[model samples]
Target chain A: MTAVTLSEARPARLRVDGRLGQFALLVPALALVTIFFALPAIYMLRMSFNAHEGGQSYSEAWTFANYLRLLTEPIYLFSLGKTFLLALVTAAVTVVFAYIFALYLWLQRGWHKLVFLAIALCPLLISEISIIFGWWMFFPNNGVLSITLLQLGLIEDKISLMYTVFAAIVGLTYISLPFGIFILLSIFDGIDRRVLEAASDLGAPPLKTFAEVLFPLTRSGIVVAFSQAFVWTIGTYATPIALGPDSLWTIGLEIYQQMNTWRDWPFASALAMVLILLVLGSMALTRRLTGRDVTHHV
Target chain B: MVWPFSQSDLFRWLHAALVTLIVLFIAVPVAVTAVMSFNDASLIRFPIRAWSLRWYLDFFSSSQWTQALRNSLEIAAYTTLVSTVFGTIAAYAFTRLRFPLKGAFYFLVMLPLFMPGIVLGLGIAIAFGGVELFGLQLYGGKALVVVAHCLWAMPLTFMVMEATFKTFDERLVEAAYDLGGGPVRTFFEVTLPMVSTGVISGALFSFVISLNEFVMALFLTTRDTQTLPVLMWLSLRSAGTPRLAVAAVVLAAAVFLSLVLVMLWYARHVRKLR
Candidate 1:
């Protein structure tokens, strides 16, 4: 009877080994990523060098002309500069709001944090397109804000604020704030409260304690958060197109326009290549600044 | 210690005012959309002349809105299933396996998370468009939307689950295995129960992402299979109507509902930990 029981367990052991051996469970994801993500990225990089005209692909004539054009063209260079500026401003605004809100929640005891958390979730859960519509309805001449301001006599008449840089900044900051707060919250949770108390006990002012104690501890987290938000805001297309004025043409919008309207896949691919480089460069800088590898952290 | 009691009241008032202003700033736009959805006017304008559910009624009665909603739901459902399953498996492998190039694999898998959607959508469109596999075209259909969405959803799910798995205790798995359970039995009886919360949250996120995705859906879908966001985009460019507001309200409602569910789940999980 013992022998028979032992023999029965033998197949189970074999089955365990067999299952591990199959490695087939990961095939779907591996295959999907390899095809849809890996291959396409490579193809996009290659296409950036190719020459396409009039919706027709020519031979495999590889050149750096696309990159050259981007450097020489005033519009592309100006848009690149503006995109970086907008991303930087958005990151700064998000960080400030996120830091204050996170500190408030951290200081609070219970349900207050929940309320703030819910508010943070609002922009994150909704579509970017919908958030644009929401802000669009609240900013223009006939929207709620203008109407309210008009009623309260804050302005002479209904004012148009939709197509402004301020609108773009606000929208981007709103959307990116949740991620910043979430990341910083985790970092703040790791900090000990007694450090702040000790500083206070030493007669340090509130601002001094925050600067001298909390800031240094959360420096890496701040860097990570800022870089993440900057990269996201830079690459984002929808909010900028819907909320930004006609004069502001972000690289994202330019890429989209090249593909959809101009049917210039080569130029679009070149623009995408620049975006990819920017993202990679940011990732490298973040890793350097944080003094640790973040790939595993993800 | 200097308590600054003289200025405490002023500080408190300032904090209160700041919080209220920020909350209003965040809430007003959403509130505007919600209120505008009920406007009786065909045009979307402020100072409502009248209030009616006409837009909501129109949204539901109209075939375009209904079909788009249906398509969005179907695509989201499928994308959620595929991403959750694959993501869970990938997460498990990353957490459990001691394979070569593990870090590289993890980075590659998560790379899509940072990639811009426009680039991904364009690449997928060009790669899959007009490509027939055994007499079937994958692009310009719901299948393409599901695939394109997976590019975003899978990475997100993996990242969330990976974080959850890091905090998971491995001794429990060993204990289950030592108790005469096979790997499958151990996983089903021990591991699944442990990570079920993470799985649920991941699924919720994937659902929301697939539903709200616009750029990918715009590129990968046709008129018949266009998701709600794509439909909304087309409609917004073509005309402005209160019915669009109704659709926005509906989308926001769906997102709000899912968020509540996730928060409840998180609350329960916190309680369990306590």
Candidate 2:
């Protein structure tokens, strides 16, 4: 509430000449979005209805075969279900870790805050591929995880967790953690720190205080964070493809496969469309349910 | 104590333990990668038998790797320039100008940032691939990737600058106008100086996004135009080598170096402003 509202600060000008100039300023952005984002999206949607030929990537005939296959075939159906489950689990786990981390950050002051913030930023600043490479180093039979366990005498022999569902989840959660922490931290900053002190002075147990005081206050933010993380995790293909077993298929990998392996452009577009819908639908539902624009939280 | 948990030694110790684990979860992988980058051996093995900068030398010497590096930098540079300029102006318009369907425009501009790279890549590739404009192929080129990157970059820049401009005091802009400064002069002299940090950070985000991004580039780039991350992804799939580790370190170094330089410049700029 302390933040300045735009309308209060910028009174509308009565002059029409400046209006024209202001409108002109938006032309470049509008043009870029229209030419790149809007047109390609529309084209992809159209491409989804086109016919697929084995020899060519796609043909110019109209058909619903792509959608028909996506809806009916057990393979595509299974991948869709898997993608949703993966995203949900990833988001849930990420939110828990991020909540704890954000609470820890909230309690800290001075240099400790800077240190933890820098640590939180590690995943964000590094490339996704590098994070995958790092884990790629960690999970192999001869990898860091195996070697460390061996040295600690915790395991009889080296074992590889690479290309497993667990490894995939670990990678997914690691990348999504920073985003969840950031969103939750912003919400935490808005709460009065003295509320916790008051609760402690009143003889409330820590668990009871958190359940009654903090949980209810941050419920909306947690929902926003979960939905945001879900939206991001659902669209990603690389981590799962790089880390997971082939049996662990998701819609993103399906899209990549359809485009790259099969060269089935129509099928790929159809899958991409479904993924887009899932993302936008989750975002819309979050906004509606919370009555909060989640975008600004980050 | 500000926190209830601070009153309990048991709770405080438990909290510290959990937070330490979380930090390690975030930090250890990066540490491992940085350490492994110097392995004298080609294979990744712990307790290095030997240590040298052999992989770094290979990364710099190989024509393929160097070409990818150049491509990554070129695309990122163009992406940074295009997105920052377009996004900054659009943010200004949102705050300062009156326009119709403003809310719709704002949503439209931000929508792309929410989209996954896979979908955007496929959409752009299919739509623009194999197409030519003015005797030039639009697909398989750095220009196309720059535009593709702007889909996410411009929106991100807009978001950052939008927040920046909202916090901005419009009175200074009015004062400039009252003092007979035109919109251009006022923007250059008065408005931009105030938001330089926001603009710089936005540009940095754009650059980093384009540099690290691969899914979109994977679809759009030919072997000739492959960026470093795309090259890394391809090379990683083919073989495991310390060279990949070196590439990871090199990429991180690029991002961190820029981040440090920006921080230093930001400090100097703030002092100057003061």
Candidate 3:
């Protein structure tokens, strides 16, 4: 009778352990990611090693010609460098402005604070296409900027600000600003409210307080925001294509054109593989610098 | 709250000035879009020549616009369904189970969150471009677009749901089990209802993001299966008109409606919890 009861209990215990239930629950998601994301990425890496045969096909012979060309080609190398630099500048501008906005939001009170937070979240929710075109319309000659300036008699004539590196930078900053602010706002919220008061009581001036207290305390958050912004800006293609001058070519656009127009699948995949590496490298570097996993922060 | 240097008048003035500038910087473009959508003049200009609903009607009437909108809606729907369900399941498994290579699995799962859409798009297109099921090509298909968007949507859903589960009370599940409820019944009657808020929020976020996403869709889809953002992008590259402004407003309307739904759901759910 005791042996029989123990046998019954063993099955019940195994069921209660939930290993089976966990397996059943996790398979669908694991399979989905494996079949789609992981497989595609692996296939892309493999394809990058194959030779592209004009138009619609690839040769079976494996080669590193695609990557070699990427290194040897002056245009491709220049675009990659340009993308990194543009990302850096865009991140700096976004982090600076967003820090100010987040600080204000953190200190404010009541309805206005609610409104400011909601408004700050707008760009984040809006489609990238909408934001690009919104700025597209705003920067041109008949745009609100020029018209308002003209009406105010600040400028004598209309000037189209479209198709400039400055315009592209502004649009990129617009898209990245809200994200940076949200990340920084959460960090700022973590600080004690009295920290600022304590700093002031210690006789530090406003600028000095910001430099010595706020900036230092939130340094990791600042780095996280900057790196997040930089990584994000690198991936985005539409803003630069629509608003940037012809001279301001980036690797994203290069990849798109190669895949779509040139139909060079091998080259495009090679470029994409390089981009993935760059992103991973930067994320690792930032993680080392901040000594934190920022996967959640952004 | 007082500023750190509340005693300094110049500092106060400058801070206010900076806030104002930042507000204007964000607000101006959205204001411009809303304002331009109403322009009677065919061109996308400011200082409203006349107010009209002409472009709104055009957006609804034009096949290019309507087809794109339909495609976006369909893809977003699938993405929302797939991501919310799978993401919830995966999140649960990650939180509850002591799996092998758990840390490595998590890092791999979340890696795509930072990946560029173009890279993901190109990779997917190359990998599955030649494949077919039932003689239907996988490339340029709406289903393919849905899966691509899922790459973006699912990880986000997973993150949110996992965070929510971290705060969840597991004793309730045990209590339900002790009362003789089976696994299935306990999941539905106890676990699900308890986590409905996270599920809803995750679903809403995925739906909205998939709706807005276009870069991947561009690479994965043909003209027939193109999404709104992809169409808008193609046009923006060549020549653009006030019609684009109308598209922007319409797309924004979809996002706003979803936002309202999520807000209402949260309000009702929070009250019930209280």
Candidate 4:
């Protein structure tokens, strides 16, 4: 194909022009990105340098005070640490559940596939607020699960699962689960079923076959899914805020508080920059783990 | 077939049970939310006093709820249109171009997707605060909300369409050119049709993201133009009412309907591929 391309492909010059023309067609989009996306980000970076005092106008003086505050403040550092922990736990839970669910869907046939599809679609389809409310109902004192447990004598009294770290984790994991399942399902679909049969014929047990053959092939997918889930969970604001206890303020919630309650634009911008860096760092880490540029071994 | 002594069978069954439990865990919250929405009482309590469509009725009748719903729908529509158009164009450019700084430009475009919504909102809000263009304030309006949403939506749409375009056969474009078709003509007649599924799905995804978005909307929207999710958040903080449940149900219904439509579209596309 490479040898055929340069000489005989002279006729394909028209297609090359077609491709170039497609680039011209992108001018509007490029302009939009420049005006809205690039400009805003640049402006934000500039704003981070501006100096602000308590309830005062931002000055033109470039200062590192905001950055210094973020570094020095225990609250900010603590919130950032908590955000990472929550995201890590959420990613782990999502991957475990998604892997098992994807495996079941892959092994099952016919009607079971439809069942899996519906289950997978629920979290993806429902609004985040609704999901929160659902859990809110399930965890509260008079909520369904608590009430049911009490009635069935499974518990001595109503238990409040709401406003707990566990609830926050559950909510984040639930929200992230669908994307994990979808991406992993695509990976699972790419695997050759006969490989498992061959492994069994070679006297390999099912667990051994999974560990040796299937796991290696799906490693990239696992990395990608976990990273995506982690990044999403880290960025999440509503789930953590609504589900988490008052003590559990994430970086996202802190940013909101800074901007809205504190009216501290500079500090908020500093926090935002930190958030952007963390997200990019996580994405880079995921890419490294997955060896994203490498060819699939299978 | 008679593997009675094999541990694999037990493992398989365990896996199946685990999956079933996980599915149930995921579904229970949604089912509970739906049931609570129909509760007759004013508060969101369990072991329901009775069942009624009171919340749904209240949602429609209340100006606050209806207005928020309208704003949410309008913003979602605008965001979808803007993102879909710009994203498809950008996707085309990325997939087809070999321009200088192409990779850098693409990275810049997608950087916003990695930024958290809170950060994006804060940045935009601060960046545009008191900044007037054309004698009009840029912040705290519908226009700003749409633009803010496009930060993520555009990149998402681009990513999806770029993947679609990568799978596109170059030979077909060559064939079109050989038949004396211009690039624009070929794009409309051939390229668009080939990637219609991707475009539609991407647009739908943008719509859903914009519709369900809360964090950014919470920051940007004023009381007059608050989106549904923002209004819900505000209400949830101040008090827990059945009206909130009603809003949840309405939003859920909209999301579910859109999701089903998209899946049906995907099913038809898969059938066509077959």
| TM-scores, all models, native as reference | 0.92, 0.96, 0.96, 0.91
**TM-scores of chain A, one for each prediction:** 0.91, 0.93, 0.93, 0.88
The local lDDT score (0 to 100) that residue B233 gets in candidate 1 is 80
Candidate 2 residue lDDT tens string, B184-207: 999999999999999999999999
| DockQ of candidate 4, scored on C-alphas against the true complex (2 decimals) | 0.52
Whose lDDT is greatest here?
A: 2
Q: DockQ for each candidate? A: 0.46, 0.77, 0.74, 0.52
Local error of candidate 4 at A180, Å? 1.6
Instruction: Give the range where candidate 1 chain B is weakest over 10 consecutive residues by summed lDDT.
Output: B1-10
Q: Count residue pairs with overlapping backbones in model 4.
A: 0
Interface CA RMSD, all predictions: 3.3, 1.2, 1.4, 3.5
Candidate 1 chain A weakest lDDT stretch, 10 residues: A52-61
Clash pairs detected, candidate 1: none
lDDT of 1 at B203: 93
Least accurate 10 contiguous residues by lDDT in model 3 chain B: B103-112
Candidate 2 lDDT = 0.89
- The parts of candidate 2 lying over 4 Å away from their true place are A1-14
Q: Candidate 4: where are CA atoms >4 Å away?
A: A1-20, A293-298, B1-7, B178-180, B260-274
Tens digits of per-residue lDDT, candidate 1, A91-197, equal: 99888877777666666657867888888777778788777888878888888888888999999977888889999998998888888888788788788766766
Among incorrect, acceptable, medium and high, the docking class of model 2 is: medium
Model 1: CA > 4 A from native: A1-19, A57-59, A292-298, B1-12, B259-274
